[model samples]
Target chain A: MNNEKKKITMMFILIATLLFGLVPFILLTKRSGELQTGNMLGILVVIIIALLAAVIGVKRIKDLKQGQPVEDELSKKVLNVAGARSFYMSLYWLLAIMLLQPVIADILFDSEMLDAEQALGGGITGMAIIWFLNWLYYQKKGVN
Target chain B: MKNKIKELRARYNLTQEDLAKKTGVRRETIVFLEKGKYNPSLKLAHDVAKVLKTSIEELFLFD
Candidate 1:
């Protein structure tokens, strides 16, 4: 694989891993009276990691942009196709979540209806996961 | 999309940075166009092509 692809994939791996790693901490923060200085430190660390990941991700993306002389028709097609696929997939997720909100609220966890904050936290995290997964997957595999 | 931006920029000997500066876009957008990983908006396509002294059709090719 080319250096550009490698860098991008590495960035994705970093981001996905960070997301997965932070989930538990973020979950802990959702519980009332569970907050602590350590939790604050953890959040701070996660933010720092995310910032670093963004820098690397942006660099990798920028690196791809540096290849203008040979940029060609196939590249555009690949971009558009992948973009469209990611778009549709994420849109479907958005719609599905909207449609299933009540059922998901009822079936998944008992507190979903009572604790609006936790429910929203979980929902946001879930959606973000889906979004990032789609982008990473499409970027890696190309569009179907 | 196939672009003659490179060739035209070369004709004028404008670097990607120069073209990007002139076009009010990021150097990355210029790079993306060059790499064909980005398809610019019609307005952008026209603007770049015009600045480079080419037609949009000549600058972009349909798959």
Candidate 2:
């Protein structure tokens, strides 16, 4: 497919993924119990993903309207750099979370919160945000 | 590395958009290239040089 068509398809898939994420989020929130810190973090993650999708969609649409190719060599380079940076940063982030898990649990839950799922969720959310921000930065500042 | 892309493009009466289109890249890529902030791949450098009717060494000046 052409670049424009490819970008549009990618945007649709992102939106669809965001919608799919919301289904589980809604189901979890509707459970017959008070929302936990983990649940709140999950909701925040969804919101961040939705916002990222919107930002990317608007930028792609503007580029398309201006008859510019959305995917090009520079963009590919920026993406690669961003992905690498985020991956590296997320490793540190996960380590910090793991090391501070007991302190976090004491402060937030007043008990042991040794839930691997929540830690993994937080790591993934942090990685996504870091990747998005890095992409935006390199896109504007130019990647070498 | 600095390049003479802007000067060469002007000699050919080509705007950045036109050069980008001819080189099959985004205008932002051309903008970055002209500013010497981005280093293009061998393929992209060759393509841009070919479009401007110049050799790669002539198009991109290495400091």
The DockQ of each candidate is 0.05, 0.83
**Candidate 2: where is the Cα deviation over 4 Å?**
A1-3, A6-10, A13-17, A20-28
| Clashes by residue pair, model 2 | none
- Residue A88 of model 2 has an lDDT of 89
lDDT (Cα, tens digit) per residue for candidate 1, span B1-63:
566677788999899888876776656567777877667877778878888888888888777
Interface RMSD of 2: 0.6
Docking class of 1: incorrect
Per-residue error (Å), model 2, residue A43: 2.2
Query: lDDT tens string, model 2, A1-144?
Result: 776777678887887888787777677777856577776777777777777887888888888888888789899999999889888888888898889988977887677874765776777788888889888889899899
TM-score of each: 0.43, 0.86
